[model samples]
Target: MKLTDDHLQTFVEQGFVIVEDFYPEERRAQIAEGIRQTLPPWEVIADDPPARRLLTDDFPYADMLFNEFILDWDLIAFVQRVLDTEDIFFRYAHNWARYPDPGAEQPGLHIDNGNNSLLPPTSDRRYGQISTWYFPEAVDENQAPMQIVPKPYGQDLSKRVLLTVPAGTIMIFNTHLWHSATVFKGREGQRYSATRIYGRAD
Candidate 1:
C-alpha cells in the first residue's frame, strides 16, 4: 500500500514509521513457514541468564514467497520516496528469532550506520540508507519489541516508540536512527522478524 502524508511526515520527523498490515495473513503465514523450514536448528547460548538462540547469515533466497514480499512494488516505491532517488538497491538481509529469557539484556541502543556510515551521521535523510523489519508473526510488548528513540541521532531518550505490532507489519527506519531490540518475555514461542536494508544505487 502507498504511504500516507502522515506516514511520510512521521518518518521525516521521528526517523521511522510503521506500515501496518503491509502483508496479508496468508502471505505472512507462508513466509513464516518458509523461514522455519530454511533456518538451521536453534543454537542456545548457555552462558546467558535466560536461554537465547540466534540464527543469522541464512536468507531464504530460494523461497518464492519471500522473493515476492521483498520485491513488492509498494515497498520499493516507499523506499525510493524516502531516499528521494529512483535507483535503490538491496544492501543486506537477515532474520532473527529471540527465545524468552528472564533478565536477558537486549542489544544496547545504537545506530546501524555507525563506523560503516557512508555519509556523516548528521547528514540529511536522503544521504543514508533505509532498513525494514518485517514481522511474520504477531508481536507484543513482552515479545522482544523494538525500541526506537523518536528524536534525532544523539538526542536523549525522552521519547521512544516501542514496536508492538500485529503480524505482517513492516517497520522502516533510517539507518542513522538510534534503536534497539528488547528481550523476549512472552509465555510461549520466540520472537521472529526478518529485516532487509536498502541503499541508493550509486
Candidate 2:
C-alpha cells in the first residue's frame, strides 16, 4: 500500500508508524513457513538465558524468500520517501524467535545508533538508518509486542505505542526512536518476527 502524507507526518512526529495488511495473508503465511523451515540450521545464538535464535549472517542473503522481501519495490519506495533519498541500500536482516522466559528481564528502551550516531535526535532531517519489522502472525500484548516511546530519544515518556497488530502488518520506524521489546508472557508459542534494516546507499 502507498503511504499517505499523514503516514509520513506521523513517522516524523512520533518516530514510527504501523502499516496494516502490508502483505497479504497467503503471502505472510508463506513467509512464516519459510522462516520456520529455514531457521533450524542456524546455531542457537543465545539459548541459555533468553531462548534467542538468529537466522541471520549469510542466511538472509542466501535465502530466496528473504532476498525477495528485502528488495520489494513498494517497501523500498516507502523507505526512500522517509529518508528523502533514492540511494537506499539494504543494511541487514534477521529473523528472531523468542520463547517465554519468565525470569528474563525486558530490555531497556534505547535508540539503535548508540555510540555510532552521526546526528543528534533533535535534527529535522533523517540520518543513520531505519528498520521495518514484519509479523507473519497476529501479535497481542502477551506475545511481546514492541513498546515505543512516542517521542524522540531523550524526551520524556509522555506517550507510548504498544504494537498489537494483525498478521501481515509491518512497522517502520526511525532508528533514533526509543524502543524496546516487551517480555514474552504468552503460553502458546514463540514470538516470531522478521526485521530488515536500510540506510542511504552512500
Tens digits of per-residue lDDT for model 1, 1-202 = 5777788889888888988877778877887887777653234333342424555534456766665556767777888888899998877777777766656776788888754456666558887788889988888888888888874545465577888888889899887888888777764566778888887886
Clash number for each model: 0, 0
**Which stretches of model 2 miss by more than 4 angstroms?**
40-62, 114-122, 152-155
Clashing residue pairs found in predicted model 1 = none
130-199, model 2: which lDDT tens digit per residue? 8889888778888778888865544454567888888888898887778888887765455678888887
Error of 2 at 9 (Å): 2.0
Top model number, lDDT: 1
Task: Assess each prediction's global lDDT (C-alpha) against the native.
Answer: 0.75, 0.73
Candidate 1 overall lDDT versus native: 0.75
Estimate the TM-score of every prediction. Answer: 0.84, 0.83
lDDT of 1 at 196: 81
